[model samples]
Target: MRTAYSVETVRAAERALMARLPEGALMQRAAAGLAAACADLLGRVYGSRVVLLVGSGDNGGDALYAGARLARRGAGVTAVLLAPGRAHASGLDALRRAGGRVTGADDAEGPIARADLVMDGIVGIGGKGGLRPDAERLAGLADRSRAAVVAVDLPSGVEADTGEVRGAAVRADLTVTFGTYKPGLLVDPAREYAGIVRLVDIGLELPGEAELEALQHADVAQLLPSPAAESDKYRRGVVGIAAGSARYPGAAVLAVSGALRGGAGAVRYVGPAGDAVIARFPETLVSDAGPAGAGRVQAWVVGPGAGDDAATVAEVLAADVPVLLDADGLRLAERDAVRGRTAPTLMTPHAGEAAALLGVRREEVEGARLAAARELAAAYRATVLLKGSTTLVADDGGGAVRVNATGTPWLATAGSGDVLSGLAGSLLAAGLAARDAGSAAAHLHGLAGRFAADGAPAGAHDVAALIPEAWRDVYH
Candidate 1:
């Protein structure tokens, strides 16, 4: 699993490490790594023109030292000091000795436009909100430049603790982060600003529990279910999908399609669209009975295109097994009912749906996805899988919120979320915890979406159809 720490935790680790290391040794290590990464990006650094946006913090020191390394190797490096008097004194001296030129922000535009590379050290994790006007102007200049922009630690002006980008921020082609991954680098809004992230190990020992975690292939593979020789269909587990209405029968078909491939022994579908589901997957155990009368299922997925089926959603919520609430269910299901459930409940909501549940603006939820996810999870005392550009799974008793980035932008099509609900519900039936089920399902769902949409538009069914392919790729 890929883990990310909060800025406060990372700062503590950095301070501890600095105390043990020789004076300036830790910074030197960081600068060396930064220099190497820059060299790799430039290919041949000797004749390149590099522009550094130096601010008042250690981030500026890192850029200056790295610039000095490039200058000594014959590159024409220029440092545009945003805070001239407050800049790292030793770092400035090193750059000057190594033949780097110094300029103020007033002269930065010309060099930025002509430079082969621009390094942004304008603000570090300590800085909050957005860039000051001067730094924002330099960021705009770098953005307009043809040069490859490299951000030191993180893209300046984004919240490191949360993935919120409040105002003007630097957009880097590559971000060379020190010590550990910040939550901002892994989550969205801010993630889009950090194009490609490269971690440079500055050796700061951190806590075991991170603020966020993204499951890698190996971690996901370990969580995937495998059948034993003695195991039968019922023994493995069955997932019930109570979804669809007369108007939107395809929602039922799509949800069942995903459930069948979701490691569940079988799918027991009980809804108005039973006929539509049977036509697509005859293997599904379709029933006319409501969720209450449906044969035993280990878990249930409720409310995808369910229209106004509040009774079915309520019935599923009362089940003893784990339940996944989505789509129309998110609207029809009462907060008290969901919270009163003895079994685990997982709520999957897009920004709009989540905004409705929280009684906030959709834009508010979208802007602060991490906070929204956590708040929703805590509100219902359930696990919440907030779907978006970066899907996050957060549990009521939070530790590390899981983030999934394997999805394509093409996955934004209709019914995509319904497929996710079924997949996650199946995992819940297969005996994974609410958090694990949500995380693993998101991982698989995203990969499937990628395979289905290989640079082309793909329907929700196309994504569901490729789940096996995604599973195989992750397994092997």
Candidate 2:
């Protein structure tokens, strides 16, 4: 798992580590890493023109020291000091000794525009909000230039902890972050500005608990269900799917397609489109019966293309088993009914559905995805799987939110969420907690989407069909 820590946690860890090390040792370690990464980015350092946008803190010092190293290696380095008086006196002196030229902002733009690489040390993790006017102007110039811009710690002007971009901010081709991964580097909005991120280990021992986590293959392998020799179909666990309407029978077929491949013992489907489901998957036990009349199931998946079937959603929610809600279920189910359930509930909502529930605009939810996921989980007192370019799973218990690090852009097909809903519901039936089920389901779904699409456009059926391959790829 790739875990991210909050700024407060990072600062505490940094202070402890610094106290143990000799004076200036930590900064030198950071500077060495920064210079190495810059040299790689500037393939031909001997002839490359490197420009450093220096600011007023240790961030500026890191840049100045790195500039000195490049100058010694024969790169023509220029330091454009944003705060000349407040700059690190030792670092400035070191740069001058190594033959690096110090120029004011008046002569900076010309060098920046012609440079091959631009290093942004204008702000660090401690900085907040957007860039100041001068910094914003420099950011604009960097954007206009053809140089490959590299940001220090994080891109300037983005909220370090929340991934929020307010006012003007610097966009970087790459970002070299120190010590630990900040929440901003992993989440969206701020994630968008940080083009490609590289973490530099400065040897700070952080907290064991992380604010967020992204599951990898090994973690998912441990969570998958396996049948014992004595286990029968019923013992493995049954997933009940209540989806589709007379208007859209394909939704029922697609949901079943996903559930069948979710390592469940069997699938019990009940809805208006029962015939269509059984026709597609002869293995499915089908009935037009409501959720109450449906046979025993460990978990229930409700409301994909279900239209106005509010009673079905309510009936499924009232059951004493885990329930996965999606599409129309998010709209039709009463808030009281969802909140009142004793059993666990997992809601898979797109930005628009999430917005409707939160009574905010879709843009607001998309802009602050991490905050929106947490707010929704707390509000409904359930686990929320907010699906988008980056899918996040958050539980009401306030544990680490899981971020999915897979999938292709080609996954925005119709009925895609329906497939994901069924897969997650099946995992719930197999006896995983709400958090584990949602996170594991997202991991599998994303991998399946990649295999199904590859490069060409794919339909929901294509993705659902590849679930077995995704499962094998995980374990082996």
Candidate 3:
């Protein structure tokens, strides 16, 4: 699992490590790693035009020291001091000794213009809000420069804790973070600004639970539900899908397509589009029996294309089995019935659907996805799967959220969510916790989406067809 810690946690760890070392020891370690990463990016350090956007903190000191290392190796390194008066005294002295020149903010233009690389040290995780005028001006120049931009710690102007980018922020081609992964580096909005991230260990020991974790292959392989030789169809688990409508029979086909591949022994589909479902997936036990009348199922996935079938959604909500709701069912289902259920409930909603439930605008949910997801989980008293560019599974029990790392922009097609809902429901039937069910389903769904869309556009069915490949890839 790829884990992330909050800014506060990282600061405490840094302090603990700093206490055990000499005054300049920690900074030296950070600078050495930073310089090495820069050398790798620049390929040849000799005669490389390296410009350092130096500010007034440890971040600037890190850049200045790294720049000194580059200068000693024949690079034309210039440090643009935003705060020349408050610059790190030792760092400046070291740079001067290594033949690196210090330039004022006004003199920054020349070196920055023809630079082969621009190192942003104007701000760090401690800094907040938009860049100052001088830093913003340099950030603008870096944006227009042919030079590849690399950020120290994180891209400046992004909220380190919230992953919220306000106003102007440097969009780095690569970010070399020290110690641990910050929350912003792993989440969206600010995540986009950090193109590629490299972590440099600085001997800081961080304990306690992480704020977020993205499941990797080995982590997921351990969670995959497998059957024993003695297990029967019912013992393995039965997933009942109450999706698809007369108007949208395709929803049934896609949802069943996902359920069939989801590790469930059988898929019992209960909907109006029975003929359409059987035509596509003959393994599905087609039935017109409502959710209440459908034979025993370990879990039920409802509302994919249920249109106005509020009564049907209500029946499923009252069922004792674990329930997963999505799409129109999210809108039509009674809230009290869902919250009052004895069995676990998982609600999957996109930004718009989340907004409607929260009584906020879609942009509100999109902007603060972590907060929105947590709020939804708390309000509904159920596990909430907020699906988007980065799928998050937030639990009502309030633990570290599960962030899906496998998604692609290409997954933004119609009817794709229906597949995810069914797959998650199947996992729930297989006895995974609500959180695990949602997280693993998203992991597989995202990988499948990537496979389906190799480079071009793909439909919902294409994504569903590749579910087995995604599952095997995870286990392999």
lDDT of 2 by residue, 1-476 (tens): 77888889988998999899998888888888999999999888897899999998999999889889999999899999888898888889989999999987768889999999999989888887799998888889999999999998899888788888877999999999898778888878888888888899999899768988888999999998988999888888899999999998888888888899887899999999988998889999887668888799999999998999998998999999999999999999899899888899999999999999999999999889899999999999999999987789999989788988588888899988889988998889988888999989889999999999999999999999998999999988
The positional error of residue 404 in candidate 2, measured at the CA in angstroms, is 1.3
Q: By summed lDDT, which 10 consecutive residues of candidate 3 come out lowest? A: 158-167
- Model 3 lDDT at residue 28: 92
Candidate 3 lDDT over residue span 202-227, tens digit each: 99888998888889989888888999
Off by over 4 Å in 1: none
Alpha-carbon shift of residue 93 in model 2 (angstroms): 2.4
lDDT of 1 by residue, 133-169 (tens): 9999999999998999999999999999998999999
**lDDT per prediction?**
0.94, 0.90, 0.90
- By lDDT, the better pick of 1 and 2 is 1
C-alpha lDDT (0 to 100) for residue 300 of candidate 3: 93
Determine the C-alpha RMSD for candidate 2 after optimal superposition of all C-alphas: 1.6
Model 1 error, position 428 (Å): 0.8
RMSD list, candidates in order: 0.7, 1.6, 1.3
User: Can you give the lDDT of residue 69 in candidate 3?
Assistant: 93
